[model samples]
Target: MRITRMLGAAALLFGLTVTPAVADASPSPSASGDDSAPTSAGTSFRTATEVDQGQRATASASTGDYLYWSFPADAGQRPTVRATVKLPATHAAQTWQVDVYDGLRRRQSCQYGAQTRTAEQGSATVELACVLRTVRAWSEPWANDPLPGTYYIRLTALNLTTADLGQPVNASVRVGSKDIGGSAAVDGSLAKPLVPGIAVSSQSDSEDGDTSKAAVLSSIEPDGGWTSGWWSDRWVWTGIGAVLAALAGIGGYALTRGSGRPSRVPPGA
Candidate 1:
């Protein structure tokens, strides 16, 4: 009876310790393990890769330069993501590494042990490599999925040869934000008068006693389109027209007064 009691207590203690550990390790299914792919902004993205070669290290020393790939210009629904990194012709037979990062500069995924081979023998000749364009290192994220923002993708060639080769390339993509892509030219309206976001107005008295009007417009967001302001469209038109008409009258008087008339007559004998 004593031996039986001791064995039972040991078994119960073991079960209690192991069960908690298993519970901690296994996350809730609904929380992170649905195996569903992440959503994105579906913006078109393109960025170059960096290439290099080294003498000491088998792979070349290359750093991918991050470039702005694309983004959403307006707010909209989230999209699914599809990204890729391409190796150029100058790449030699060696292992390479590709890394993906989030907006916070945190490394999300790293994939190494990639090999490349080409059937070429000349410097100018193109070397061909075959691999999956889009690599998925994880089926699901550890915590929440990536939110709408800019993300970076980096690729480095490993085990490179001792020769000057292609440059390293890095690219970025805007994941969810609506303002992540190229912009177009905005057409001006009468009310707006194409006044830029930051406009500096200056009035200076010239040597000839005429006031010169000059303004510099700084860059603005939603630049190439109509923008909202304090005044209504009708009120803005009325204000702009009144100011421009007054300036035009002043300019006209200056031109007429300055025309065919010398500020000072030549000294007479």
Candidate 2:
């Protein structure tokens, strides 16, 4: 009876300990959208017009054409952008690029990863991935800061070897936001202009100078990556290890209990 009671107590403890970890491990609901078909020059990031975060937009472009989209972001939020291009048979083997820009119109440096393949009948598909760092201000006063605001993504086709210069390729763009666990100094607004113009009113000379500097800083390089959110976090793997240990303990305890049972002898003996 004592052993049975001990086993019951252990089972209860296991339930209490593992339940919360499982809940914590569950994934948060992500914001996502898709654009099946996009129009030519469908949106402009220059005008601060962009698809909402967690949403996707599609468009068709040819050589020398640009497709743009914007999404809102906050400090400590890691934003990821992906672009996929589907080229027709005639547009195969062309070079393409995707660039990321911050609210100040500064060209942000990003880690880029791409894959290309020749499809059936000379068609090709290209996939591009760009991941932005947790938004934050620059440490130096003269350096360009990645503040909380609308970020833009530009997709362009570089060179076309095909004779059909007008041949259009379908492209899709997607943006995702993940919380890296920090607060920003300020929040961002979609209505705010990408580059604030110099103040004409009699404001402080310092304030006016700051605005002018930001406009010129738009050309600064960006910092970004190509990894997904799940792979970027360390705590997730720790939780997984804890759960596995608890399960192993329970299985071992059950086997020992079964082995301890007494065997029955035949009545004829």
Candidate 3:
């Protein structure tokens, strides 16, 4: 009889412990993925392959126009470039080529193929095209340790005779970094010595703690499919919830201080 009684007590204790554990383990519906979906379309910029052309050049016959591509230009310094050149409606040409250089310092070339019609407007028309002669033009991958300086791009128009066209050279190239899809190297000035506006907060429970900021700015999703957010593995909210629950349990204990204690004076004595 006593053993049965003990078994019932043990079963009751086990039930109490197991109930909360099971409840905690049950999955709950939640808004989990991509909490910060961009409300508007993202800004279009050049990728490593796409270069940027900022402004048009004044008319010139002596030499072709030059375009400038800036590094560290945007928040993330994406390494791609784009440029547009509008040819005079009267001008006719059969072949064209583009030359990309390291701003009169190191000469590099990328042949973006031939000019194709992109758009047409009143008195003026735009052709979407690139200057690539051979399969591998001279465009090079952006350097992580790029020296702070100016780079140049030269566009040339070829006539039907496969030679220089008398028409003036006027075009633009938009310059930017390619979509590395990985972390760019950090420089000392922009890298170290944490500043409020600069550093991205690290995962709370990360081994490095809050002290670790991302080495480089994150322009896109992380490389390994990892993500950052409130519900992400090391979120502070889970710790916050546990803290609040502990406080509540403490308060409940304090409230029950006298519930089980016998009074000094006998009841109904």
Candidate 4:
């Protein structure tokens, strides 16, 4: 009975040490009511308009233009992107779509939402939306799980009549996120968001007004830089320590277990 009690205590201690820590729930993403945000979208990834979560972004462009916007996503968030296109008066039907891509430029599949819509002839607007899977703290190299990073949204006219190609159009995009909190946390988090470094002019521009001379990422970092958050690879070392502790408990129990009463030589001569 004493040995059994010791073993039980060891297991309980191990469980306590390795229990996954969870953070308190934080507020949801901000609302899209900020009117002061810029009202333009980028034509390409390099120039993608960066917006805060749930910020309203609008742009005026031709029917077939590709409008791109980017936003940061933290772990445990499920980001949903909704886009609306105000179409000019036209008799031709058209198809519009909004695609979400990770910072690696890899397209992420939408778990739900109407990602594409075909506007009927004379329709005033077309709306599309996408709900991405929950962001993960960490994932295996072979897995394509969504991780905390900078995500991009690309809106374009997928199918349109040739005559409607250059028709004037207006678009608005909003990205909102739902925080799932610590329920979906894993052993570690990414060291940084997969944000690209924007090109910056060389300091030589100070002497010469010409700003053409450029330096790549060598000098510039993304605004605020990247952070690892609370979770990190150190969890691996913690897990190893827990395992070693459990093993040591078993070894100690084996060395000291049972036969507490000193054994006398059985009927020693």
Number of the predicted model whose lDDT against the real structure is largest: 4
Model 3 CA deviation exceeding 4 Å by range: 1-76, 108-148, 159-164, 168-170, 176-182, 186-269
Backbone clashes for every candidate come to 23, 9, 33, 0
Question: After superposing candidate 1, which stretches have Cα over 4 Å from the reference?
Answer: 1-91, 110-144, 164-269
Deviation of model 3 at 96, angstroms: 3.0
Local distance difference test values of all predictions, in order: 0.31, 0.57, 0.34, 0.75
TM-score of 1: 0.24
- Per-prediction RMSD in angstroms? 32.1, 12.1, 18.7, 6.9
**Per-model TM against the reference:** 0.24, 0.53, 0.30, 0.66
lDDT of 3 by residue, 1-269 (tens): 44355446555655665455444333222322333322111111121111222222222221232233322221112223344555555543333344444322345344343333323222243434333221111123463222222333444443333233444445544333432111322222222111122234444324466444544222322123211111221223344456556655665666677557667878786
How far is 54's C-alpha from truth in model 3 (Å)? Answer: 5.9
Give per-residue lDDT, candidate 2, residue 44: 63
TM-score of 3: 0.30
Give the higher-TM-score candidate: 2 or 3: 2
What residue runs in model 2 are displaced by over 4 Å at the alpha carbon? Answer: 1-28, 31-44, 47-49, 115-121, 137-139, 162-164, 183-269
Give the top-scoring candidate (TM-score).
4
Q: Which run of 10 residues does model 1 get worst, by summed lDDT?
A: 49-58
Over 156-186, each residue of candidate 1 has an lDDT whose tens digit, in order, gives: 4445566524454322221221121111112
Of 1 and 4, which scores higher on TM-score?
Answer: 4
Model 4 superposed RMSD (Cα): 6.9
What is the per-residue lDDT of model 4 for residues 1-269, given as tens digits with 9 covering 90 to 100?
55577667667765664443322234354666687775898999878888877678899999889999888887767888989999998658898999999877889999999998999999999889999998887788878888767788999997677899898999999887776654566767675555554223434465675755644322222234443346433464467567668766776777787567667766764
Q: Which run of 10 residues does model 4 get worst, by summed lDDT?
A: 214-223
